[model samples]
Target: MSGLNSQRGVGLVEVLVAVLLLSVAVLGFSALQMRAITATDESLVRTRSLTLVRNLAEVMRAYPEAYVTGSGATFTTVLPTIASAVPTVQAIATSIAIAEADSGDSVTIDGLIISINGANNCLSTGTTTDDDDNEIPNKLCSINQLAARDTLLVKKTALEEDIKLAVVSCPADATQQAIQQQMCIITAWNDTKALIDDTDTKACANSDGVYKIGSHCLISEAY
Candidate 1:
């Protein structure tokens, strides 16, 4: 009887050890699953951002003059506020929203890098004062005031890519040349990225579904 009792106790100890190991394995597997979800979410958003950049490129190619400076010129990006949201602006913005919906991503256009001009140069003086008397970083253009040959060009670049576009001259072709020098449009948007902590990414806050995050602007003659 004594021997049998000892054997039973040993069996119980072995059972408890197995259960503990199994619990640890379960917890580890859960963590791995969470990580996979995060990775997948980030990948989808990145792909969507790429798609947006490409679409903007195609749109501007058809309307180069609308965005770039004439005579092989290019301008820097500026954010413009809405003076009054006109029907034309609405129509254009709507088109982009529709495209995003079709692509299964929810990011929308949030920034416009409008082109600015000054005396005989597309580049602006860093110390120039705006009408408000505040020293501005550079001349940034408005979005709503686009006119003939003026543009709202959309471009995409990687975060690791150049912050400002390089010195690229427009080709001789009239259509290509239109997006040169002082006239240009560069747009950026927000998109959601995966989060391990999920604390402060407003774009992705409401639900697990993707939203907009950072902005990336590119110029004509850029890739």
Candidate 2:
């Protein structure tokens, strides 16, 4: 009987040990799963930001005359408000509310033009001459800029909850001719704002325009 009792105690100890090991394994797996989820979210947002940046860049290239003024020789400063770039300006437009009527439903929101700096519409009456001295309407001359503006506004309105955009000049100061041609299209999501054209210690980008550690932002240099 004594031998039997000793055997039973040993069995109980072994069972407790197994349970403890199992609990630790389960906890480790949970931690790994959480980390994977966080990483996936980060990657998804970065991809979306890249897409938005590329789209805007292409649009700007298409609208070569859009940013130029004064006989189409000088570049117009698009971003008049420097301070508004860092903390993103909140733009308001007609709101569209969509409710899920059933599974596999489709929703479309019509474009509501948002004016920047109280600028006139592209279709407004204005004309400029091309290199060949061909008379061009303002709509044709600045179509690229208009397209870019429309794209930014529409994307902002649709993805307002997911992302923020600031179309700022690259050098911020635009002092030099080489740097004056570049523009910075910054897209940020979830607690990350790209560094403005300044040397702020807490900003995402450094003086060299490189992304710093722990800054959640994607900066694209557009010509």
Candidate 3:
């Protein structure tokens, strides 16, 4: 009877050990699953940001008149800054008037739509000859600035709430005209925390257009 009781006690100990091992394995698997989900979320945000930045670049290209003055002239006015806290379409639209004015286009900020000289429609080329038979120079709402503003406004409204966009001078000390003409579009979002040892507040980026350790942002250069 003594030997039988001893064997029963040993079996119970073995069962407890197996249970503990199973619990540890389950916990480790759960942690791995959580990490995978986080990675997938980060990837989606990154891809969306890339698409938005490229689209902005394309929009700028389409409205070359908004930034270009002559055959080879560079951008005269700087791009507007979009803060992460208040990423509103009207904010972006209202701030673009400087560029519009530089392009010889008078614009009025009315809500999200920037009316060039109070014109409702900007599709018109606005290229018409006056009674004097002289071609109008930089005609109002000439699809130069107004269209750009309106299109950009629409795009801004479509941005995800979690994503933030900002415009900065890339390569802060670039001397070449080509580099100087280009602007950096930064798309930033919250991701995993930095390593415990990392201690950079501007780890993601800075006004000087530099990315440091633990950065969770993407930069795209646009002209």
Candidate 4:
């Protein structure tokens, strides 16, 4: 009788151990599944953000005239509205701001800003010439036609640099030109530090907006 009782007790212990092990395995799987779901959600958000940015860029490119001449104050488009499964599509705008730098006849091209609700304000600084002229021609002429061509070159460089820096930092993810413009501003600030030492004012005059150590043009506007 004593031996039979001992065997029964041992079987019960074994069964309890098996149940505990199974519970641990189940919990581990649940944790892994949750992590995977979270990762997928993050990826979807990033993709949506990129798509929104690209759409705005395309819209801006399509209306070059509107962008250049600064015709209408605002441009708007309706995105395809989707259910909760995906992000709500939104129309975005590429805002262009041009501003004159502290020194030099060069102009800066600030990058674009994107909005989700289509109610965001985009402010851009006006571009100025060496003569302190704020009128930026719709079409840039050759150096012979107008000395402002050099300023345009500098502006273009600043815009391109902003894009490149953003691409490097984010890799596959797309970012609005706003961030890139900010980076260019910092770069421009650093470049201007040595301007006081230079006596030659003709260095960046006729050439394109490429900024060298001694001879550099400031970017006045971004499109």
Cα-based lDDT for every prediction: 0.34, 0.51, 0.50, 0.31
Model 1 local distance difference test score: 0.34
lDDT of 3 at 62: 61
Q: Show model 1 residue runs off by greater than 4 Å.
A: 9-13, 67-178, 181-223
Query: Ten-residue segment with the worst summed lDDT in candidate 3?
Result: 68-77
Report the C-alpha lDDT of model 2 over 1-223, residue by residue, as the tens digit: 9978766645777889999999999999999999999999999888888877776666556544332222111123333234322111111111222122121111111122323223433345777889999997755324433643455454553264466566655554444332125767777676665456345655657666777677778877777
Local accuracy of candidate 3 as per-residue lDDT tens digits, 63-180: 5434322211111232223112211222242243234332333333222234434454455565678899988754444434454455444344324335556554465534333312
**lDDT score of model 3?**
0.50
The stretch of ten residues in a row with the least summed lDDT in candidate 4 is 84-93
Higher lDDT: candidate 1 or 4?
A: 1
- TM-score versus the correct structure, for each prediction: 0.36, 0.58, 0.59, 0.31
lDDT of 4 by residue, 1-223 (tens): 9988766645777889999999999999999999999778656544443443343333333332221212122222212131211100111111222233322222211222222112222222344354666675343222111212222233333443332101111222234422112111112222332121224453322223344554333322222
Q: How big is the positional error of residue 16 in model 4, measured in Å on the Cα after superposition?
A: 3.4
Model 2 spans with C-alpha error above 4 angstroms: 9-12, 68-145, 148-151, 154-158, 171-180, 197-202
